[model samples]
Target: MANGTGVAGASAATASEGAFLEVAGLGVTFGGLTALSGFGLNLEQGRLLGIIGPNGAGKTTLFNLLTGLVRPTTGSVVLEGRDITGAKPHVLADAGVARTFQNIRNIRGLSVIDNVKVALGLHESPSLLSTIFFTPAYRSGQFRTEQKARTLLQLLNLDDVRNLPGDGLPYGAQRRLEIACALALEPKLLLLDEPAAGMNPTETIELMELIKRVHREFGLTIMLIEHNVHFIMNTCERIQVLNYGQLIADGEPSYIRKHPAVIEAYLGAGAHDA
Candidate 1:
């Protein structure tokens, strides 16, 4: 449910305005070691951008920096033209940024629908006192919230699991639930990390299609951290390559596949052996 507040129209807004997330000179450090250095990109409105590299390439760390999960050592992160460098996660969410983790973190005690309700709750007002008093506005707010929750569940085809406890879901369904929760926030920029980690090949293909549909229909600007080269290459409009926490390549999938340095840094051994 969306809390009767304005929704970002995630599937359609970017397709038209064509301006979305922008990142520049992004860097991150841990004590003495730099985990991410000078990473940057301009994600066009409504485009799916893939981030890929070997396991330790700082892919997810970049995500942490973007979502305020970690503060950048230096650089700027602007979303929809607003400066949000080092903004709190909730502040970022209120400003139309939402994310799913490398691991799902639904409220294990709540049902699928309740988990989504929490996202919608972020925008709901009328206060605990108002809710306890059952004022007209509170009643209306509750109604709107329920409607929004139902709509989001149906949008993600999780309506059947609405009543089921989040911890009871199958692996793939749990992943989708995390996405559904993020969508409930109606964020303009959606960050998905390892979305296909536990999916089977069939599930992977379907997940790719689902992702495309979400991006195209919702007008979402999607930035994903994924290891599946086929999934990344087939789905993203552009891809950024990271290695040892440094910016190594940035281009379309086709360009990246043929990049000499990229091949040398990542797929060189396999290509040479072949």
Candidate 2:
């Protein structure tokens, strides 16, 4: 559904107009092999976008590039009009970017609430002197942080297990916990990489609803990478298809579903009716 001329013209317009998250001519290579090439995107604020491709389509690589886990070989990443290319992960976090991994990465021994608290602490920690002296200010801050963590837990439906160890939670709840922790950062842009990777059908459906709720309640711009075509087609307002590090389609679900290249590359020939 995406033609080179249209995409290029859109990229040019978005660059000058200042998109919320703008990427242009993004490319990455490891050694001599190209992992991603000529990637460009312009994500407006408060939109839920999905990226889908087969394995090794550079989905994770794109996330890595955006989060500053990897540097691009060419191009720029701009967030809210500020160039963030090559920014460190912590710097990106401070700049209001947050993400969850394909695999859950909760703190193994930390309480579920504590995991969220830790992320909040990064942005709202008390002064060292106050903490060392156990000052009333520090105590008050801790209480406030705990309350905030509890609210996030409740939002993710993990309040009942707030005291339980993060890694000790069931797989589905652990995934939710990871999302809660990311939300604890109060990010403006949230990137979810295969949040439903191992979820059962019911869990996947629930996760889809939760994602929609979060987007609505928090008014956050989100980008998701997933292999589940059905989930992406249902949840995302706009979708992009990639193959061998190249984008083949970009449009609404109906358009992407019917795109010849998308069907051939990832959705298969039978997906014409999808």
Candidate 3:
């Protein structure tokens, strides 16, 4: 077990060759409880990585740390050679990081398009005075924003229900809509937490293809936390396993599937029985 201290002395280092994102000696504690400890990994540009663990394994906590939802008790987060540890969420967003939550988060009252617009609005820098007077610049900016939003919706295959309320869509579409909203941030790194949580086998398979398409089309470096072993095994290029807030294994899917520590600690004894 990692105890609360996590991996020790995982310090920020010179960017590794092709290292787009890196975290070293990352640990977090809530009072006496240890959420994560000694957690560290490197993500290359344009690679899709998956994190898997049993419940209470501090998976969501890691996502929170990456997106600036909470600060870590120890360690550093580096993105493209910049030390972004403890940066605020908005600051991280500005720095090209975006994420979708484990639960669907969207403006249920707002149309699907408007949900995306909210994300775009966060990074807009139009002068308030121009908007007060309805200046051409503001109008033009809004027009361009809408056009880009539409393009993103189309890319994610959500354009058909662009006018529907986000909450009105079926569970899977709502998940896709959330991803579209994240895309509006124009992120270089996108974190998806449990994207296939409620989908059936067919939907999950479809989502797997969609994820691959998104990664190829956008040229993004993506990381996801998913509970579905089959989904992660099939989708991600590399896999990291977590148990008791510690990284028990990290490797390609084939290696991960057979790692003894992973099977004993999290994957369970019967994992290979079938």
Best by lDDT: 2
Extract clashing residue pairs from model 1: 1-148, 1-149, 10-218, 10-219, 11-217, 11-218, 11-219, 12-218, 12-219
For 1-274, candidate 1 gives per-residue lDDT tens digits of: 1111111222222232324666667788899898988766656677788888888889999888888889998877777778899999999999988999988888989999999989998898578888799999999998999999999899888998899998788888888899999998999999999999989998899889989999988999899889899999999978878888877777778888876557867766567445
Worst 10 residues of 3 by lDDT: 1-10
lDDT of 2 at 138: 92
Q: Model 1 segments beyond 4 Å from truth?
A: 1-19, 268-274
* Candidate 2 accuracy as lDDT: 0.88
Per-model TM values vs. the true structure: 0.90, 0.93, 0.92
The lDDT per prediction is 0.82, 0.88, 0.87
Kindly report which residue stretches of model 3 are placed more than 4 angstroms away from their true locations once superposed. 1-18, 267-274
> What are the clashing pairs of model 3?
6-37, 6-38, 7-38
User: Residue-wise lDDT of candidate 3 within 126-220, one digit each (tens)?
Assistant: 88799899898899989988998899899878999999998999999999999999989999999999999999999999999999999999999
Q: Per-residue lDDT tens digits of candidate 2, residues 106-206?
A: 99879999999989987788888999999998998999998899899988899999999889999999999999999999999999999999999999999
| Steric clash count of candidate 1 | 9
- Top-down lDDT ranking: 2, 3, 1
